[model samples]
Target chain A: MSDKRNSETLPLAWIMPGALLLLWQASSSLGWLSANILPAPLSVLASAWTLTLDGTLPHNLGVSAARAVAGLLIGGGIGFGLGLLTGLSRISERLLDPTLQMVRNVPHLALIPMVIIWFGIEEEARLFLVALGVFFPIYLNTLHGIRNVDPQLIEMGRVYGMSPRRLFRRVILPGALPSILVGLRYALGIMWLTLIVAETIAAKSGIGHMAMNAREFMRTDIVVLSILIYALLGKLADSATKALERRFLRWNPAYRR
Target chain B: MSKNNGAALTLSQVTKRFGDTPVLHGIDLSIAPGSFVAIIGKSGCGKSTLLRVILGLEPASGGSVASDSDAAHARLIFQEPRLLPWASVAANVAVGLGERGDGPDGAAAARQALADVGLTGKADDWPSTLSGGQRQRVALARALVSNPTLLALDEPLGALDALTRIEMQSLLENVWQAQGFTALLVTHDVGEAVALADRVLLIDAGRVTLDQPIYLPRPRRRGDPAFAALEGAILERLLDASVSAGSR
Candidate 1:
């Protein structure tokens, strides 16, 4: 019965997007909309198809994906390590927390000029930008998760004579996982946003670069297609994280359903 | 279930203080191995503090807290189940085994512990899915699975309904009998102290004022004449201590 309900509701989700697409197509065909301002959905798809055939779209997309993944790994590793350090140790928190807080307050994107000057208008600059943007949310959320683990459970773990390593593996890590995952999901969003801004401003390759090149030639179709691709990528990232959350946190009461 | 003979716990002038305020004042007691001892007191009378000192969770301000040098280990059960919501009941039970739990035998021992608690079929269930009574039972299974020589219960059934509390008391008694672990229970209930403990100690104003032994046979009922008499004597001591405290 629930499956039937889900099937019925699934089509409803498409209705609004479908209607908008129909309106876009009608306006373009009727000349009610200028082609340069916004290309029809069908024209964007056709251009995207052509780009796919020529391998330009796929190649740029692959470059952007690699950059995003690399930045996430670097930033996530640093954030998780520092978070554990600060969360578990007062000494570490005292030594490192204030510096991180001060840096976190500075808008990461604003550092783009400095980054470009230091690293040049190369892939390094974009990767650095993405990594900086992805770092803090994960750090803060992980710290919050670790700090919030119930003291009672920790006491029980100690009373049971658990060694420090076992205590962390069995108790602290699992307790902090839900919050860490939340941070990761948030970081994924910042990851794409940072990459887009970085690539659009300065890059020879990638989806953002593709869109910027399209603007120079007034190929609005490709521009619209690129934007749609980003939207699709963001949606895909979100769904992937949600799947991960379900798999890892099935033991959590809130996630059981 | 190993029957350890003679004193399992030795407290020599064990005193605990939070800064200047002393919670346990020169507490000296000896608990025999494989015996059940309950400490009873009003809230803030330091019964819980004594248990914490005995379990080595808290340091004594003065004096020493020692157990049998050869005792295998000690485990504590709190009023709350304190189960990890992110772990299954079986996994939570396995936690009691300490480092031994990370091995393959942990799962098998957890299964057996769950069976001992009469929760054989619910090993895979989440703690959230279990009722309050059932959760406490799981806590028991977790504590018992380690096969500790000493079990420290700090108001382990304080949150249960009267009926569930009575049932749990029996369950605790039977486990204590079978496991032959040194059981030290701290509670506020007079009847419960008399019902489950082989010896009862009353704490008041940071001291043990009364230490009485109960020689009643097993399956002691709350309504039995001997049970009521023992309960009344402890209650009278508590009342006398409070009266003296109030006047002082």
Candidate 2:
């Protein structure tokens, strides 16, 4: 019965997408659905091919990728430093936590207008938006990771006469790594989302800009292709992050299993 | 060096209390170096507290503890293995050495320590994958890796099952004989105390009431008459304390 169920479900997963494509092709051929609003899947694939052949896809992808990477590094670095400080020191936590909480409560997207006013609709403004989006999750998780380290392990380190630096490096950091990785994964996703949003509003060239330009020209095929590309990029980023997480947390029971 | 060969722990007029309730009354005791001292007491008698104070993990309200302070690198084996769940068996054992930066050489030392505990084959295994007994063996290897002057044990085998506990007791004996470090074990089991220690100290109401030497030879069996007699005598002292507490 289980094998039968598995065999039935296996085809259903493939069939759903196949049936949708067939319906889309039939509707477009019969002129039931207008190409202006929803272009046929074949047309979207053709536009994707044209964009790739003309190097437009690679250029836009490179711009977005570079921006995302830079923003992640800057934001992740600051978040990790501040999070470790606040987590390890009670005084630092008392001094910074309330102010950070209040600031973090404000939606980062809401600050785009102010950011544009300050830095203009330049690269700086877009980078700032991506960084802001990346910061919160990494900071929160790093702090959680540090705070959750076992007190017994700390005592063991002390008893062994470990210097403060050695204790942090050998015991505290490894103990907190699993949570920090979780934060990194979360922050990466938000970084991409914020990057696209920022690019869509003001950027001259990027996937998001491409989608916007396609919409203006009523090139629904290009827009659909760009959306598909964005989805693929997000999935690729997530899978890479997962691979890194597994590599680092190999000793963790959950990862081992 | 000769004077340091016997167990010597000196606690001068120690009095400990938690809030208004006194746990250990004014107490003074000196143990010779190299002596295997087992402290046995009923729950709430402050035996564990006494061990903690000796280890400098806790402070006594009144009294000073003077040991060979230069021998500051004492190792403790807890009731639970307390192995770091995130570290492999080898890495956990090597934690005592801190970050030596010697790489393969330091790893070899860790391997040797695990081998001493008969865990060489399981060096790369995580603590979670190991059985309760194996985890305790890993903990024992961790403690031994430091070559500590003082080995403090707080019911280290109290959680093991009967068969495993006995096996661990033998392992402890073998390791103790091989290393010859001064050991202070806290236990509620009178039989365990008699079986393991050169001398047993019975604490009742936070005060040492009995300090008896066990002259029984090494490799003493639990079923032996000498071991049974010592166990009975410790049991009697514990019962006498309870009876006195009731009369009070």
DockQ for every model, please. Answer: 0.78, 0.55
CA RMSD of all predictions: 1.7, 3.3
How does candidate 1 score on lDDT?
0.90
Q: Between which residue pairs do clashes occur in model 2?
A: B6-B32, B6-B33, B6-B34, B7-B31, B7-B32, B7-B33, B7-B34, B8-B31, B8-B32, B8-B33
lDDT of 2 by residue, A87-185 (tens): 999999999978888998999998988998998878898888888888888999999999999988888788767789988987899889999989998
Model 1, span B1-248: residue lDDT tens: 43443338889999899998878889999888788999998888999988888877788899997877443477789999999888899999998887687688999999999998889899888888999999999999998897878888999999999999999999999888888888899999989889999999999999989999999999998888988988898898888888888788
How does chain B of model 2 score on TM-score? 0.93
Task: Give lDDT tens digits, candidate 2, residues B70-170.
Answer: 44557788898878787788988887666652377668878888888888799998889999999999989888776777789999999999999989988
Which parts of model 1 are misplaced by more than 4 Å? A1-4, B1-7, B69-72
**Among these predicted structures, which one has the highest TM-score?**
1
